[model samples]
Target: MKELQDKISKKLGFGCMRLPVRGEEMEQIDDELFCKMIDTFLAQGFNYFDTAYPYHKECSEAAIKRCLVERYDREQFLLADKMPIWLVKEPSDLNKVFETQLKRCGVTYFDAYLLHAMNKDRIRDAEEKGAFAFFQQMKQEGKIRHFGFSFHDKADVLDQILTNHPEFEFVQLQINYYDWDSEAVEAGKCYETAVKHKIPVIVMEPVKGGTLANLAEEPASFLKELHADVSLASYAVRYAASLENVIVVLSGMSDLEQMEDNISYMREFCPLSEKEKNAIAKAVEELKRFPTIACTKCRYCVDGCPKQILIPELFESYNMTAQFGESPATTRLYRKAIKDRGTAADCIRCGKCEAQCPQHLEIRKLLEQVSEMFG
Candidate 1:
């Protein structure tokens, strides 16, 4: 296995955002499955777990406590948690979140604690809401070993944060071959800025929310033709980890099979060899052939919208409609778009979302089209 640090070995960090569940609700956390996954993970010599305040919507930290922390000694693994500032309104709530996170995890301290989901709006809100001071206070109190944030914003905001908070130990970013130069995501520029800031990187979404897994037929066949044992996903994770200054590559393992596959490959980590690297290098071009709106899944526009429309899924459905021309798949997704939430038709063009969107998408216009198509 590749040693990230002598202090704590890193193979692939376990991201608990989309843990496997039974039916619809996440009340039951698949303990037997998750514990088996963790046991297999540790047996293979991998030990980094990343959980957030609202991962799986208030279930991640507690799941880790049961599936991992409670079962293993503190010294045996490294735990990473985040202070979810987006969930907060008042400044006093910062300490409350931090304290409650510690309590829920049943851990005295965190190896790495980050400000989660830090886009431009969230970062501004954090500073104005006294999160920085509270973060510093936690560091001084010995509650946090290292302080950082997971970001989803433009390069400038990243630069500003790194310049402003040089003391932060690392930055977690959504890095993958597909999003490297994407206008919607720009993973390359993000990674470069982090490198320029001399900040170590922890990569998330290397497989792009399982988007890479369900490739179109041609690419799927191409990948299948390449390797019999490895999956289409292994190439993606290998590509992300091949970058410089990347200390951790996190895959949100949803089940035992996924956990095993990721662990097996990451255990004896090797940089993608010349040919495999070249093949993965062509992923962006291959991905461009697919009909997809350049949505990065950042959800910045949805955050501040008065209408609360799910903009990302709108584009995703549109892309699906455009590509596959499949009525059932696209329409089912479209109907589900507003089944429990707002739709494009409700957009009043308050422009709150436009201001926060790092991609500079003409969200007002997109909403108009979405309303026309799906309303």
Candidate 2:
């Protein structure tokens, strides 16, 4: 266990969920730019790269193959992947998907493997499907070196999972200052639960899917007054990394510029000072004044929407209007979000989206608000 932990000693991990894309298409990865970003990330001695089955419409694994795995020596980096247990229809589907992920990434073994996006319902599904046993088997066979799960849902659900499955070595959580005490995310409670179980945490959405990075005017200005030059995103990432139990902070950098910006601060990592902590506290309160949708753009709700509503993009448009007030740019963004997809008014209220949402957002009701605002 100590040996494996040594391999992933770095605090910053390259999240492949939002890799640079061509135009607006999710799967259209720009190989040239992606290669440059990876080269720079590794050149700076940051070696961990995380990917999953469903990222980028299922193209992320292959992109990693071409950009990282095939280009760099296997021992040069630590790779992490997740099993989409929800897609496991039967027992055999487990090995089938694992083997496919291996082939997709062109790797014989993964440094870290996780049960993706686990919640209370999915926890039951994992137990009934023998996912835990499968993970043990994979570890023994050298197919996986470390095993855990990425979590969503409440802290109580997290506590239950950790209590029930102490074998899990670590947990990936959605942790950021903005959502730290949020009733919806409950990041603070969840972090404490993981610590209580002695499981180290790997933080995802540390910037709240770029929400904290691009703060609304008041919070942004408040943070700037304290640290005039630092990026707003850096404060959020450092906040997560400051936690003693957290092993790594994953940033879904979409371009070379974003990657460089992250590496600039994280290269010589520093925990937040007393004043910085106080600044973040003030910023969080200021941000809560705006009635913006707390969508992290995870896009989990979009996959099951029967109307094929571009849920996250629409929410982004709504947040812009809510924060900055109505403007031509907001109107254009809303139009672009609805183009070739279901509009907010077209929702059938089938509840599939709400069921799948990690934030437990009242998405149907939120869509109604979006419709009224944009219509």
Candidate 3:
């Protein structure tokens, strides 16, 4: 595994989920910008790219094929793709999807392939469909070099999965500081489970989907005082990278500035110091003081909301006012966000939003709070 780590050489991997888009359209990926970012990433000596079936509304794989696979030599970079196990209807659907993934990525074989976004229900579905055995056979057939699964379940489920199928070479996990000790995500325990099984860890959501990157003023200020130079995001990425078993930390770089910022710090990789960790601890303590919404801005709730509330944006405004006391400004922002859609008070308690939320938040209740605060 250590030799495998040395083979890749760089600790950063370009995540394809949030590729730079042209204007407000996600499907229309900015190819020129993406090409530039990839060029810089390669120039700075990173060699890993991770994409999935559903990222960018199913466009991420094809974009990487055009921007990366077509431009760079196959040996110059390693590509990691995934099977959308949830989309599989039966066991035979697995191979059909794998073939499509390869075709979409313009590759004969993937360097790494994963079972995308597994929880207990999804994993069980995969098991019933014999998806795990399918990947193992694919490995034997030289279709995939490394076979693994990206997890979104609890520690106990992770333990069961690893114990039941130890063939997985690596486990991609969400491992940011905010969710490190979160009872909901159980990130800390999940990481520990992977380590216990000697599975090499590949980190996803190291910035908590940009939540840790764009910190609230209080914690950001504390970190600024300590480092004075590093971006708030650097601390989060570095913290994930510093862990012993983490082989790659994926960041979904959105623009040239973000790409350069990531390259600047990650080009010369360094671990977080004890003093920096202490600062993060203090920031966490301070963050706990606010009645802030614990939203990662994943926008999962938005897809199912009948009222079309811009839930994440509203929560951001709520946070700005409630946590940082930027009320007037946040009030204005809130009004603007709700201009074309439903306000916090407009939620009809349909229960669809809560059902879809990965965080299991009482979104109905939270919306009532947002209404009280800003309505």
Best by TM-score: 2
Question: What lDDT is reached at residue 67 by model 3?
Answer: 97
lDDT values, one for every candidate: 0.80, 0.92, 0.86
Over the stretch 4-78, how does candidate 1's per-residue lDDT look in tens digits? 244457647888877888775656688888888889888888888888876666887898899898999988988
lDDT of 2: 0.92
TM-score of each: 0.86, 0.98, 0.92
Show where candidate 2 strays beyond 4 Å: none
Choose the strongest candidate by lDDT: 2
Name model 1 segments beyond 4 Å from true.
1-5, 26-28, 294-317, 327-375
lDDT comparing candidate 1 with the true structure? 0.80
Residue-level lDDT tens digits of model 2 in 198-301: 88899999999998988877888878998788899999999999999988899999988788889988998889999999999999999999999999999988
Ten contiguous residues minimizing lDDT sum, candidate 3: 1-10
State the TM-score for model 2. Answer: 0.98
Better of 2 and 3 by lDDT: 2
Candidate 3 versus the native: TM-score? 0.92
